[model samples]
Target: MKKFALIFVVVLSLVLVGCGANSDKASNEKKEEAKTITFQSEDGKIEVPAKPKRVVVLSSYTGDLINLGVNIVGADSWSFDNANFKDALKDAKEVSEEDVEGIIALKPDLIIGSSTMKNKDKLKKVAPVVTFTYNKLNYLDQHIAVGKAVNKEKEATEWANDFEKRAEEAGNEIKAKIGENASVSVAESYDKQMYVFGDNWGRGTEVLYQAMKLKMPDSVKNSALEAGYYAISPEELGNYTGDYLVLSRQSSGDNSFMKTTAYQDIPAVKNNRVLEVESSKFYFNDATTLEYQLKTFEDFFLGK
Candidate 1:
């Protein structure tokens, strides 16, 4: 009779242990379910971590993500190419939409990319993928959209407002020093092509024309404003010159045109009213680059 009681007690203990294990599993699953929330992406709603810890950027929103305090483990080549992003992305690996296996190895909690990225479906299978169409929203709105993706909309919005105010103030100061009617032109040369940009394009055009309310020459406005950028021959560069010229130049680019008589004869060039910005740094209009640009422009006009 005593032996039977001992066996029965052991069986009861095992049953209780099994029930507790099942209960703990269910509780864990419920907590996991509560940790994710649905985000209304550009295409449709998808679940994303409430606080993403490891993010992989497959697009140009690197500066935006950095500004919003996201921990990026991987990013595209273009982001790595941006000079201003060098220190910020020092620990990040160069990843692209084509790097499926590489990205998977990074163990990213979220992935942000462009709408036209080829590996969208494949990436989604590895992690939640969010994409944005370029220029679909203005720069500030784009930042806000990125913030929402990372669950930091309020911080993004606050930065946008503060940046706008500072830019406007700086523009007023610049206009006062350079004359409000003075026109400024932004141009850059890469490979065999020389191009002029409109207000929305990078190279400080957004800060100069949009945020600072600086003046753009009629010729550039007619050509680049609608199309974003217009290619011109090196000889025709002078045709787009304004009272002040912002030359977005790369250290290694074919700036041989600068030594040409046609370029030197331009009023802005002859008068030393040209501000040369590094192409890699100026190529992006994100918060990191924009702040550098704003200071550059201010010092160029307001100081020596």
Candidate 2:
């Protein structure tokens, strides 16, 4: 009887140990079942569990995320295109820059931002933050970087490919409409100085000259290649004078430069070939925003 009791006690202890092991195993399995997603960021690489259900976008990538069909729980209330966030991003929660408390209140899973976020620590404390830097005119690289960050690499590549194809097609269409030899000049005025875009200034200019096959007017050819943003007098407008001129309106609604006699006398202006573009649109070179810039040029130059 003593031997049988001892054996029974040992058996009970083994069964309890086995049950504890099984329970531990089940808990680990549950933890493993939670999904993870990887994000390629400018600061470094980051991995999060599953698709971020609550996201906050701080800067320019807002449009890119919207295009990818990501649900944004919070966002900065800045004018991306002089349009309200509601207009640009429907159903997304809007937050202000100073509203740290408000952002935290939302309990976001992820925060998509640009390098401009000043409060990195505060933002990270709220949630995982992924930041990006804008690459001028290299829309493909920009798309790939942002896409990988959001687990939409394939979609980003497709969008980039389509963008390039459309840009090339637009270039071809512009070339056919305006002739291959057509000279074009793009410029903006700030504080009484004229800033002409160079070949390497932004992707739009590269597309206009390299892809569209538009020639830089002889006056602007040398200056466009010059280093730094050079100032040109309204009298020297002839130097930038081309078959077509693209001017960007000043942010403060200042059009004083356009009223200058020298500007009015330019061949492009006299012939009404000058197209006015928004300064904001002319400056940003992201894949998503680039389409608008390309379309603006196509519409202006090709009348399409």
Candidate 3:
């Protein structure tokens, strides 16, 4: 009787162990099933992993996702100078617009890019692809759209609202310090070409016009602001110069243009209100870059 009882007890122990193992496997399967999601992309209805574990971005909007605390696995090489992304993306793989195979090897669960990317069909084969047409919406609106794509809309809205309030406060402070009618202009010299910008372009316009409430020179408002940007010859520089100038020189040691008699004749340069900025940093118009520009303004304009 004792030997029979021992055999039965051993069999019962084995059965309990097997049941536990099966339960664990089933739980793990359920967890894996929940990892994916269906996203309505610009291309059409496509399914992507929720909170995508690996994302490959092929646009300058990498900063947008980073600000939302998303994991970025790869990105385009164009945004190398964006201060917010440079350090974090330093070790990230650099993928080209047409590198579908390259992106596939990265094992991305989702791909984000511009609508103009080459080989869109090939990219879609590897993973779900979402493309953005940045020009269709204003800058802040574009950021919100990107946030929706990454499932970070709540954080994005909070940041946008906070940023707007801060910007308005900063603008009011500037007016109090420098008078409400102070004028500012953004200009850059690139490859022997000069550009004048309005409030939309990256070169401090958001801070100067939108945030600080500074006035643009009539020539700039009539030209650059209407068309987004205006290209002018070296001799025509004075036409766009304002009470303050945000000068971004692309090449170092090319003081040739600045040394010219025509350049020194600008009223801003004569009065020493020219704020020299690195072209690379000033080229991004996103909220992250705009914060950097704000800090710079605090120091330069208010002596804070």
Candidate 4:
């Protein structure tokens, strides 16, 4: 009887251990299932399974993710230049331009990026990567595309709508201040040439020209407006002469070009209508930077 009792006790302990192991297995399966999420790539098409908790952004798409209220594990350093992004992901790790190996080491479940990434194959080998190609589109469409990729399409649309409304209000105020005939030109001096941006450039040209109904001078019509962005001799600045000139300041130590005689004779210089702008905000047309550009324009041109 003593031997039988000992055997029974051993059997009970084994059964309890087996039950606990099964419970643990079930819990792990549930956790794995919970982690799964459908993520759309930058391409705005292909959807793949991504672990909802771990996300790595390799582009300015960090703004979209932030707007979507998603937490990012890592992001490209360039995104930090914008105040909105910097404030949103203060603790996020920075991924360098050539740091695919480092990114893979993070073991992120979803890799969000642009077409500019060099190590696409390597990144994909480590995890699922979604890339988006940015282009000139209606702001609403662009915002919606970003929202869809981040699984926040509805919220993105609403944000875009609100942005458009605010932009329209700002445009109206600018129109009131500048009047209908006030011509505007946006240009940057670089490498002894003047680069002018037009409707195709991703700044606020659409709102300025289309929404606000600002006039484009005839001199900048064919050359400046047609090519979207074109470089001309400093002597050709006469062609860009408008009522308001928005000049983007080249970086320091870039005096190699600006010291030339052609830039001095420009009407914008003589009239003192040239407003020097920050190069970083001028070139990068992301959401946060765009707002900065708009505010700068308002302060410089509208006296707001």
**Which lDDT values do the candidates have, in the order given?**
0.90, 0.71, 0.79, 0.69
Where is the poorest 10-residue window by lDDT in model 2? Answer: 79-88
Instruction: List model 3 lDDT by residue over 1-304, tens digit each.
Output: 9999999999999999999999999999887667666666667777667677688888757778777777777888766655567876776788887777788889988888888888888888888888987556666776777777777677888888787778778878877887778888889898888899988777778777876678898999999887778999877888899888888875554647898889898888898989888887777666667777888777878887
Q: Which tens-of-lDDT digit does each residue in 164-205 have in candidate 1?
A: 999999999888888989999999988878999999888899
**Count of residue pairs whose backbone atoms collide, per candidate:** 0, 0, 0, 3
Off by over 4 Å in 2: 1-34, 76-78, 84-86, 93-99, 190-193, 199-203, 210-213, 217-238, 250-252
TM-score of each: 0.88, 0.75, 0.84, 0.75
Question: Candidate 1: deviation at residue 148, Å?
Answer: 0.4
Residue pairs that clash (backbone atoms under 3 angstroms), model 4? 42-130, 42-131, 42-132
What would the per-residue lDDT of candidate 2 be over residues 1-304, giving only the tens digit for each residue?
A: 9999999999999999999999999999987666667665666667753566788888766657666666777777552442423554565667755678888988888887777677877878888888876443254666566667667788988987777777788888777877888888877766667777766455267567655667887767777656524568656776776898878665576677677787788888899998887676665455545666777787777777
Clashing pairs in 1: none
- Give lDDT tens digits, candidate 4, residues 193-269: 67777764654565566555677777677776767777876667767768877777655636444455776677767
List the pairs of residues colliding in candidate 2: none
The best candidate in terms of lDDT: 1
lDDT of 1 at 208: 93
Candidate 1: worst-modelled 10 consecutive residues by lDDT: 29-38
Give candidate 2's error at residue 186 in angstroms.
1.8
Candidate 3: residue pairs that collide: none
Deviation from native of the Cα of residue 277 in model 1, angstroms: 1.0
